[model samples]
Target: MNWMDTIENNNSVEPIEFNVVKVDHNISLAEAIQLSVEKSGYEVEFIETFYGIEMDIKIPFLVGTEDDMINVNITRDDYTITIDIDIRRPNTIEEKLDILEYVNDNNGFISFSWNNEEELSLISIWMSRERLDAVDMLLEHRLINIEMGNAYVNDDKELIQEKLAQRGELEVYRDEDLEFNLSGEWNATHGFEYRYILRDINELINAIQEERENILRFT
Candidate 1:
């Protein structure tokens, strides 16, 4: 589902935080990025750094200042590569839709904040590439609504669904066993409000990788 429908339908809301997705380590960071940008009708130049590689991927329609471009940071550690993209400037509706569609087609996730004008506001989409040789990515690292929350697993609907499917009843409780623990509250209108916290995000990412069978699932 798209953001507009989801935002309008939700009775209550939480603060929008950065979202992350993981893919396998297949192509080099440089190559994968180059292909992604060039295929999107943008050109990229990589700057090698002591820590890793950096690139400012430029979209023709998005060019104005350096801050308007998409900044990509790549670093390799522990047999996996992480690529983070920060959209420095606010994107138009069309641009946002195009970028989201492209990333989804490429088996990646894009996260960003939304200003819905109504009482609803927060938005984040964490679409993980469930396979090997895929890039692990997070989008929109902007910090907003600081008082609301700062945990990554705030979006725990999927986890809740899995539990319900297995147990036949919603076990609404704090699952400390998971790297990301979930806390629950009873909402009179919404029934149950579950908040997910990233107790150890790294552990979650590694576990996702271990659970992936192969790239064929994605293909």
Candidate 2:
């Protein structure tokens, strides 16, 4: 079954009610993040930070097994609030390549950065209070697939070949429709960086749905 089916069929996991609100410019970023977490029915454990507040939050919808606990780190700069999670650590070159392909295909809701020294891939979603609900949905969908072990690497070569062929056929139109641009350089020493900007919540949700269709088509 696809992700939406999985979400519908599974009743053990409680649905999180995302309290989307316009971010008050007067309030601090830490307070904003904390309020969001609390509204979602999770306790926020604040981690001391020099600039903005850093905290660990557990997203219940993303948890699969008893041992599965997704760690979400929230931080902020002068302008934006950043939510970062370590999605996966690739053990082989093929796995890393698979992740890169996935990132290229579905970068609308999240941007990715790689750590060469640690072999870690970080999935980051930028959010404003107004777009928090959409961001939360996108984040949950991505993490659920990751936990299922099918978001990135596929062991079936035939399926991979079919997906590549399908993608090749749609390349021109997809490029025109999405109008995505790649900016940044990859270095052996410094690793890689990729970022994408979404204008609004509709754009983000569309990206997530398109990505889901891609996965379902292959499977």
Each prediction's whole-model lDDT (CA)? 0.31, 0.36
List, residue by residue over 1-219, the lDDT tens digit for candidate 2. 422232332334333433433442434333444565577676656554554334454553332222222233333211233434344455677756765675566443244333444665454434332112222233345632433555332122332233334444334323454211111111111110011111222233333333333332222
Model 1, range 91-168, lDDT digits (tens) per residue?
Answer: 377645644553445433323322333333222223221111011111123332223543223343343333334332
Instruction: Give the residue spans of candidate 1 off by over 4 A.
Output: 1-27, 63-67, 77-219
- TM-score of every candidate: 0.27, 0.38
**Top model number, lDDT:** 2
How many steric clashes between backbone atoms does each model show?
A: 3, 0
TM-score: which candidate is best?
2
- Off-target runs (Cα >4 Å) in candidate 2 are 1-17, 20-29, 61-93, 113-219
Candidate 1 backbone overlaps, count: 3
